[model samples]
Target chain A: MNVALRFDPVRLPDHCQDLRQEVRDFLREQVVQGVYDPTARSHGYEDICRFAKAVSERGWIGMAWPREYGGQERSFLERYVVSEEMLVARAPTRRYFVADRQSGPTLIRYASEPIKQRVLPQIIAGEAMFCIGMSEPNSGSDLFAAQAKATKVDGGWRLNGAKIWTTGAQHADYMIGLFRTSQPTRENRRHGLTSFLVDMHADGIKVSPIEMINGVMEFNEVLFDDVFLPDENVIGEIDGAWKQATSELAYERSGPERFLETFGAMRAFLTAVEGTDDTRLQEGLGRLIAQLHTMRRMSVSVAGMLEAGREPVTEASIVKDLGTVWDQALPKELRTLISLMDYDQYDVQAYRERMDFYTRMAPKLTIQGGTTEILRGIVARGLGLR
Target chain B: MALDSDDIHVATAERIFSDRADLQTVAHDRDGAYRASLWQAVEENGLTIAMVPEEAGGVGLTLEEAFSLLRAAGRHAVSVPLAETMLANWALAAAGLEIREGVLVPLVPAPRGHLAIDAEGRVTGVCPEVPFGREAGAFVALCDGPDGPVIALLDPAACRIEEGTALSYEPLDWVHVEGAPAMASAPAGTAAALPEMAATARANQIAGALERMLDATVQYAQDRRAFERPISKFQAVQHLLARLGEECAAAVAAAGSAADTLSRGETGDALLLEVAAAKVRCGEAAEAASGIAHQVHGAIGITREHALHRLTLNALAWREDYGTEAHWALKLGQLVSAGGADALWPLLASR
Candidate 1:
């Protein structure tokens, strides 16, 4: 008889609301300081570096990480709460993400004590950037076929290969590289790979920007030629790389960032249209709003698991899949919506650049960390679908 | 960010119901006492009085609270007059009866006849299928006037509960009255309150079943091991459960939104759409929840001994209680059709 109703969402803990306000205040201060413009930060990524530094100063970065490594060590739900606050503020937030969402945990799981101590402090401080190196030319859909190779040398490894789509490579000081280590006998190619942490400054390591369909050089083609990594740089055990890579990928795959890409625009749309009693707008808005709300809850739930010390890979996969569809749906849905009204058609132009920007950037949404097809296969295989 | 009493209320409701309404045990009541007790508990908890103003001697929680609470009730799979009670309360309130002090209300969604209570308080009605008519105090309906349906309060003493092996074991009956005194409607927009009024308890039932279904499926996934691992680890089960979880989450959010909308006195086709969607989804969700749960539970789930049948049966019963999928679907279909061919464009343009 314990299932009696005594709770609801409107009744969130008082502390959560307070935290939300605190984040709002910080965001307001940043806006007052003109650290980020409304247009630039509406999508939440303008002063990405400065934003990370400021957030770290407040101990907001790595809020859920253990305090020993410069994290505030808050509950996952509380972290989720902060994410919501940041979203509501529409602040630029790309920089602190790795430290907050992934790197903190990745180091805990896969890094050596030295690496955790050396890299985590800077990461926590947002002094270092990491452009995740996962995808290659033919390896977009099948990530394990990464042709990137790291040859064993005396007391070190000389990594030699190419990573075609590395996000933030221009600024990143280091890269988490998946490479072929053990020789594959054709049949067991996937299991033969190992992961490495390569210094971008190493000899012959080249980072060339790849202009995307969005016309932004946010992605890079990284080539490693005789780039030697000291034995000390080996992040995880040899041949046991996929486990580490997967744990890192799980962290990469989940969170509110998936659906929150266009949340600000949606809110702006809501605020701007208050004067009208348009029936068509309400119906269209209702369906999409409902979907966005659904995606957030699922994403939040997965974050809850991450906070609870559980690896919710399958859960994360579901969120990523659904979130991508909804995110991409923004443009398609708006296009359909725009064709209806003359007013919306003009307003659509006003928001067209950003929408187009988001649309092009969205293909990377699924393809960067893991392609949708690949993730689906993983999910299906995980679910015994195959 | 603070969770209101609504969430706590649902948690408390589901906890109590989940414990008692397990499938193997509910058969003993055979009659409706179990459901009656459950319904009274709901009333005592102030769920029944949710819409009444605080001065009216009720808990005065919003409709959202009622929606979530009833959903929890649905999850417990307890069959009763609970949702029907709200329909009746709405009629009484519409008929100008003090919900706390007057006779129990008649809850049938479409009232074919009327109950009339005059200033002298003489009551009369023929409200067939009025819930708990044999064991209630007041009943409210609308008698026909020169202008249409007029609100009427009726004496519970005048009505009767003629239960004849009802479907799904939740008690059902009719209230019959002749020459009942009739009162006017409550206020403006009261005529349009049917969708909101009917949706309150029904939405709750859906939320409850959704919660129960999710819990049962999760529990089964945990309990049932196959191929050397718990079946939950099976990616296919994970995907199915994930989709079920998505449906439940969406329903909970929508039902909550609809309840909040109703509380604001906003009644329109859109509001109807929200509630109707929740109803339809909840019905489907409950069945899916139960089916996925039973699937995970496997053979023992099909047996009478397993507690899942309580959840499944309630899901089955609630589907038909107020309206089935077909009923709500047709309602939604009509609403969607209102947009004409291009109706979907306006609805979709909400950006």
Candidate 2:
């Protein structure tokens, strides 16, 4: 490893490192052939996912999954390198990243063997997509008390509830949802919840798109009306959904992705502005870049922990809590410079689409995966605080 | 690239001190304990004598290794007078003076105090604001020599300490020094270097505490819900907390790097410029971070019962010490003004 490049010491497999060149080669080829525009990279999920699928075909998707699932049997380091490169490339991989990184890992850890065998291959192949169904109305912060209900039925259970602010659910194939299984009697309200892999296409499920502030329907409100599930679809032990899913969140919340959200924009802004004089942008950008480096180091350190077979729950919580906010604020600081700068190939509308889209979606990056508050509670608990 | 000893902050220094509640409690008092336990552990770990030449009855470690230790201290909030004592020992060692372990308070020149190198090789004077004066066993006295203010080591027994002053930490008092031994005079602003060194030290400490405070505040905001959601999800507060964190981190890197420059002996206006910039920025950054941290934390953070106050208090105290925002601003302003107007390019290029 080049010491200059070492912000944090997460282990990447020797092969994973080679994957960087592969991503670059492919991206370079696309750019050379005028097949993809770097300026339009972050705009649409479908376009971004198209690029992700290209990389996925090279055995990058679910790279660390078992070979039985058509995965490359690679390491987290390898997957991390690929993810980071995609961000640096400023290409959108929003569509399938969640399923591959956290949802797949969650299922592998707590899903029934049947569920894993059924879903892992498809997820690894980039054919099936999953969105989280944790947050809901009246329970946005208190996720466990979510009114999403799963009543007992003849063969399995009937799930009748709604999840709001669901990201990319309009396009997702399924949701790994945590619904209330047992009755909520103050004490057991949180403990009685169970997780299920609900097919979004199943009967009685409704997906209505929720346009974001930036005017995109990348997220939606997923309403479940007596959506039934087979008993075999239960994730982990009954009412242990919270436990099963919280582990996945640790994976979700940490890593370079949390903080690196706006690097492309920031870099684009940097390329736009040239004078290192007393301009506020230079000062702000300098501080921003330095701050970004620090967060990256912390995130990399957490990556190192996960690589060593440690969950690094508290550390990951710290990273996500810090990273998401840092990532989101970059554009707010750089918007002026971004306004001044122009891309070589992209027209104003194309560039505006990418910038406006990411800016709208920026707010949820912190709220989703895990809310800052919930992560802090975890950190406090890690500190043995009440 | 040659990394300055102060620039490299490593994590290996996590070994000696307690990262548990005991240290946190000591760090959180209405007036922190001055972290005596942590200080002792640091001394044993060779932080005090870490960079002294082996012949000087020390561990003889390189400044490169020591800076890594310093950065780790910044990260962990290890608040003892590590840098003050180190600068003192470095001065003493450079002077070829024999020494033993104890606190070395800093003395700002009294202005009226005259510097004289006696035939017997004894130097003496009275200076003001000798840091930790009431508690330290020795004082590094800065007095007006013919050339300028030269810093000399004074025996603690040779000076008289007054009652406690109006300081936040209620640290040791300033002393009136008379006759002290083994003193030597150097260039005019040699003693001024003490603040830069101290600035480097306190700035990092300031950065560390700011980091901890921001971290604790952010975590608290996220977990403690208000109006049906984590406060962190609120767009306004999210912006506030992110800015706070950025300020904290900028201080860390700037201060760490300035200390690195000083450690590498990048002297004169060049070194002073970086130090002054860092000092001013760090003071402002620390002040802003601590204030915003308390705001984000709210009433719960104000209680003596909460650990957040420890880092905040440390930040409040550290920023005021060595140099405040005004003090460094004046110093930097003088340099910038002297360099003429349209001067940022040359100044930056020189750096």
User: What is the Å distance of residue B328 in model 2 from its true position?
Assistant: 13
How many Å off is the CA of A281 in candidate 1? Answer: 1.1
TM-score of model 1's chain A: 0.89
Tens-digit lDDT track for model 1 on A278-373? 556545655555455445545654665675577767667766776776776787776565456566433555555555666666666665556666
Tens digit of per-residue lDDT, candidate 1, span B145-252: 444445554455544546543345445566666554433234212733653566546655666666666666666676678899887777777766665564555456
Compose the digit string of candidate 2's lDDT tens values, residues B1-351.
223323422433555544422435654665555466667766776677765678987766555355445545654555566666776766566546554587766665422234443545466555544446666667665555555445566666766677664333546455665555644434324335665767676776776667567667767877889999888777667656655755664565566556556666678766766666666667777778877888888756667677666567666766666656566655554454344423432233232
Worst 10 residues of 2 chain B by lDDT: B1-10
Give per-residue lDDT, candidate 2, residue B263. Answer: 61
For model 2, residues A80-167, the per-residue Cα lDDT tens digits are 7777777666666766788888888877878888888899888877777788887887778887668889998999999997898788
Model 2, first chain, TM-score of 0.86
Q: Least accurate stretch of 10 residues (summed lDDT) in model 1 chain B?
A: B342-351
Candidate 1, superposed: residue stretches over 4 Å from native: A1-13, A41-47, A87-90, A183-190, A245-251, A344-348, A352-354, A366-386, B1-80, B86-201, B207-242, B252-351
